[model samples]
Each structure stands twice: as structure tokens, then as C-alpha cells.
Target: MARGEELYITVPSMFRCPISLDVMKSPVSLSTGVTYDRSSIQQWLDSGHDTCPATNQPLLSKDYVPNLTLHRLINTWSHSSAASSSMHPLPPEITSGEIRQLVSGISRRPDAAGVDELEKIVRFASYCEENRRFIANLHDSIEVILRILIRDNERVEFLESAVRLLDLILLENGVRERIQRLIFKSDHEKCFDSFLSILKNGKLSSKVQSTRILELIASTNDSRQRTIGEKIEATLPVLVHLMRTETDKHLMEAILSCLISLSTSRSIKVQLVHLKLVPILSRILSDPETASPTAERAIKTLHLLSTVAEGRTAIAEDSGCAVAVLDKLMKVQRKAKEEGVALLWSMCCGHGDARVRERVGKENGVTKMLVVMQSEGDDRIVRRMCGDLVKVLRGIAMAESSSSYGQGGLGSLETKTTHIKPY
Candidate 1:
């Protein structure tokens, strides 16, 4: 493992927090005799839960007794010859005053040195998970980055660092809620327009970071859908453009992830279908080279889109959609399997035509359904749904066969499936 500038042999298991599964920097003992990181335990308790998250037992006291000895041991291990070579020690824990000073420095002069300090602060906070937790709710730091973004003569270097830092701050729930309100609560649509503009015209790194923040804002847990709806409408076209034009695998995954989150809402799903995203997603899913997260999010997005009538018809009319989904069944991750099957079921459900059924049978759709049912027995819903799909496919095949026999020729079943355009 690598720590900051040092190469380490290994991290001991005892140094890990049971709740977060991350290395504990500030070990603390709980009343239940289990030791945990102070922040992790404090957050767990702060959420109004009395039982331990790692062990469901109720706590006798909600106090976090600091384990000073273990803390010292971790400090020694961190500073010891785990460093293959001598390097600068880890930066001290950043204070609120120091952060304020850094922000002030940048505000005074948005030059190279100011940007350097900004990037340096961001880099230090990323050194360990604890640092990220510490900086997660830094509203002042976020405001400084925002100032950098809106400043005249915006430096690409500064913009990138500022956006990266903003992304890190939004990881905390309280920061997300506050930022959401600050941007969207006052009916200031231009603030959102800036995000779309950056996404369309910013540098590569800035574009990625812009998309990340836009995704967080769109996915905020607000009861008011009007703001989210507006954001989606403004951003959908740019998201489609990015998905098609981006060649970087990781960037594409992030874009698709945003799509998945946005498409979960019924209103946004309609806009996506109208924009004709079905075929693009289907082609991506069929490609063997697509990364797993991208494929999973694509398939899930398609599943949500299929819930609407336009979505189902769009998916079915495309020649590759059903075949693409079937190709991935029982071949990808578990959730992908479920999504693929669900989409196929939606496509074939109301299509009572002979040609569509025969096409499905010829495409090996029925055979794939059977294989998925067998492989996914542990999931009762998948098993039941796959069985129902096979039944429907067989019924279509039987009707097609009977019609062919009545015409007294096996060649009668060779009719091509017609694609009907949805109104």
C-alpha cells in the first residue's frame, strides 16, 4: 500500500474501522467494547441510532472514549520507516482559520500561486479518508472555488482545481443540501445555466467536474420536482452530446451514471425517450468492451425508460434493443441481469403479433430466457419473471406455428417483424 509519499509493507487489520471499513486514524472505544474511528461512531450516533452499526447491539452509553494508546501506535506507524525513503511529513490537520486564510489568499489574487495553494489544500485533504470527512462540509472552501469559477480571466488550472475541490466538499450530506438551496432555492436559473455552459464549453477536466456537480444537484432529495425538472431539461441535450462524443471510458461512465440518476424520475424519462436515447444505450450495452459500471447504469436507465409507453416502443422498434439486452443476460452482473430481463419483458409484453414472436424465437430470445431463469434461481422475482417471459414467447411461437400449418407450409413462419412508430 502507498501512504502519501511513502511505500508501506501492509496495513494491519486492527487499524481498520469495522463500520466504515476504512483505516482508522482516531481510534475510539465504544460502550459495547468495540473500538471504532471517532468520526464514524459519532456520525452513527448523531443519526439518532443507539445500536452499533457494526454489531446491532444497543449501546450502554453514547460516549466515544478516545483510545489514546492505539492513536499513538497508528501515528508511529504512519511516520516510521514505512517510508522507503525520507520525505516531508504529512501536513498537520488543517484548521478552520487556515482554510479561511487560504480562501482569502485566492480571493486577493487569482494567480498561479493562489491556485497552487488551492490545489495543495485539496491534495492534502485527499491524503486519507479522515481528511475527506474533515473537509466535506467546508462551505467557505466551496464558496472560494465558486468565486474562482465565476471570476474574469478564469484560468483553466484554477478552474480545474476549484471544481475538483467543490466535488470533494459535496460528498457530505449537509453540504449538498446547503449548496442545493443556495443554487436552486432562490429561483436563480442562471446559476444552473452556468453549469450547462461549462459542460458544453469548458476544458476536459472542468467538464467532468461540472457533470459530477450537476449530477449531485439533480439528485438532491428535495420534495419539489420543479427545480429538478428544469435542471434536467437544460442539461439533457448536453449530456447526450457528451455521451456520444466522449472517448474516455471513465468520463463516459460518469455521464451515464448521471443519466441513470436523472432518468429515474418519470418526467425526465419522457424527455430522454423523445431525444432517442434508447438505441444509443442499447448499442453500448451490446458492446463487449463497455466497462461494467457504465453497462450496469445503461441497462438500469433503459429499464426505467421502458416503464413509459414511448420508451417500450422505442426499445422494441429498434432492431438491436431486444437482441442487445438478451445478449447480456446471465453474462453481466446480477443487477444487470435483472434489468436486462425486465426490459425484454416490457418489450414483448403487449406485442401480440406473429412476426415479433417469430423474430424473438429466431433471435434465441426464448433460449436465453430459459438460461437466465436457471442461473438466477436465487432471485425469486427474476425466476418468476423469466418464466413468464418464456411462456409469452412460447405462446407467440405457437400462434405463429399454427398459422404456418394452416397455410400448409413451413415457409410461412419466415415473416419479418414490422417496427411500429409510437405516436
Candidate 2:
């Protein structure tokens, strides 16, 4: 044994149990629902106590359920911190044979027992990074997990665990592409269809993970995007609804990233336009408190959507759109600002009548364009856009001025137009 001087001098409060006043290596929950260090709780029960030590309530039983999630969190914290690492031993390694045996057992049972075995394997994998890497390398691993996932009659816990496991495996480099190719080669439309079903009907956690997996699959290439777009009739609306309703930032960001990818296709852009995604994007952009990266994606997606007629109409219809685009002129990141400007130009330059141009001018768009042009140290493209926008706005102003003259002072209007070049 080591000397007393080598023992831990202090433990983190969150890592300690109230009963033992020491770091908990194996935390467990008692019948009263109070958690304590397993050893201390067991010792108290072994003394024939009839009440919970923490709650002072009558015990339902002496049994305890392992807090696997909390245990994983503790293990992660212990591995990552220098102070904790000195006092704790890391989890043991899980070998390839063990993983294969677990998979085979799950495949054979397919009952509650199989689910317990699968959950055990998942817990073991979640305990350490090495276990995940080992599982990722196993041949036919994705196939086995997908097989279990596609079973309609399985328990929800089993499906959730299967999705979580699949996500973990896909996070490994090159694994996503392999799975993509595997699904493409096989008759696996049902595999992809299962994702839409989950997104529509699964619990919140499962829906979020399923969306992540769909985004990963959608990002592979144009062909895959088209494939998914054609198969799922309600995919676009579902994503837009989630973006509008989901409050989680990461989930919203994931949905936006997938939207950006899907909107890249002109064919699909029309479908997205029909879904009226521009108003949704405009809402996100106009809110000053929106996250910077999320706003960037919103405007970029708007830029793509603006390539079509319906998209331009939707944007112009939103009263805050011009201001939203103008708000990002110099306020957001460079890419976002560039996209915002492009979207604004698209709204004005292409088939935008005098009424549209006047609406832009009414929003102080001309002054904003001049500010962007005069600001130093910007990309040449942005400066060029500023100049073009100023010219267009001034031309519209001149045309509106001439038209308002109503042929009563055509000569006077011609003289004023000649002097209007500077703005």
C-alpha cells in the first residue's frame, strides 16, 4: 500500500456522497431514491437498519439500481482531470471477442433479455473511448445495428440505444461514408425510411438523434440529397417545423446545416421554396439575439433559396427581410454579411419593380449601402456589391422622380437626373 501522504487530499463535492463524505466510485440509488456511495449504503443495510440513511424513511427494499449514465459521467470526469486520475483506476478494456459475443447474443434473443444485453454493451462502450473505437472497427457492425433498429416491434429503449450506438460509431472518421455506401448498394430504402418515421413519432431524444443521422446522410453528396428529397414527401416541411419549434440550439443548428446542404440543388430549392422556408429564415435573421453561426447559416440558405421566383416573393413579402439583411451588413461574420448582401441584391436587381426598390430605400437601404462602401478593409466583392446597390437604388429614385413629374416638367426632371450621379 502507498503511504498516507500519497492519498487524495480532497475530493470534488459533486463526486462525493453525502453519507460517506468521500468520492463515489460506484454510486447507486436506494429505495428512497437517494443516491449514496455503494459501499456505505451496503454497510448501512448490512447493519439491519430499517430506514434509508439519507432520507430517514422506511426502506422499500435493500435493492439498488446502477446509475449507468452518472457512472459514465464520473468516469469521464475522472479520466479527464489530473487530480482525479491519481486516485481512480480507469475502466477495463472491452475486447473484440466480447463485442462480437454481445452482438451475437442480442441477435439470438431479440427479447427483453436481448435488450438488456444490448444496453449492457452500450454502457460498456460509453464507459471509455477505446471501446467505441473497437466497436467502430468491427466488420458488419453497422449492418447488425441497423438490423436491430429496423425491427418495428422492439422496445423503445432498444431502438433509442441502437440509434445512440449508431451515432457514436458514425462519429469515427470514415465510418459515415462506409455506412452510406453500404445502404446505397443494398435494398435499404427502408433503412433510410426508418429515420423519417422516428423523426415524426419518436421521443424527443430519439428524434434529435435521428435528425443528426439524417443530416449526416444528407451531407454525403448531391445524389444522396436528391435521393432523400425524392423519397420523403414531407421532409422539407418537417425540418422547417423543427427549426421553428425546437428550442435546443444544437438541434436547431443541425437542422439548419442540413437545410443549407439540401438547398444547394436548384430542383430541390423549388420544393423548399414551396415549403415557405424563407419566412422562417427571415424570422431567425431578424432576431438580434440569434446565435452568430446559426444566423450565418440562415442567410446562406436564404441566398440559395433566392435563386428562384417564389423564393424572392416570399422574402419580399416578409416585412422585416430587408432590414434583416441590412442588419447583417457589417454586424455579423464576413460570410454571413456577404450572403446577406447577395440576398438583398437578388431581391432588388432581379425583376424587382420600382415598388420593391422604394421599399428597400424606405428601410434606409441606400444609406447602409454607402456605409458598407466607405468602410475600410473589406473584400473586393462586398465593396463592389455596395457600389452596384447604390447605383441601382439611385437609378430607382431617379426613375420614380421622373415618373412622378407626370410630363409636367420633363425638361426639369432631365436636368435633375444629370445631377443625381454622385449618390
Writing each residue's lDDT as its tens digit, candidate 2 over 1-423 gives 445444453556767776646567678888787878665565445433556765657677889887777777777767764554465544545556877877766556544346766666676665445677787877766767777766666656667787877875666657787777765544555565566666666777677677667666666677665565565445777877777777665566667777765666676788887877878788887888876656777878888888887787777788777777787777655556777887777777656645557777656566677666565245677667766777788655455556666544445544534432322
Off by over 4 Å in 2: 1-96, 104-113, 224-228, 353-356, 374-378, 395-423
User: How many angstroms is residue 112 displaced in model 1 relative to the true structure, after the best TM-score fit?
Assistant: 14
lDDT (tens digit, per residue) of candidate 1 on 83-191? 3133223654666567666766765664434665776777656454556666665545555556555555555566567676676555555776666666664444344
Worst lDDT 10-window in candidate 1: 414-423
> Which is the leading candidate under lDDT?
2
Q: Over all chains combined, what TM-score does candidate 1 have? A: 0.65
Q: TM-score for every candidate vs. truth?
A: 0.65, 0.68
Model 2 weakest 10-residue run by lDDT:
414-423
Who wins the TM-score comparison? 2
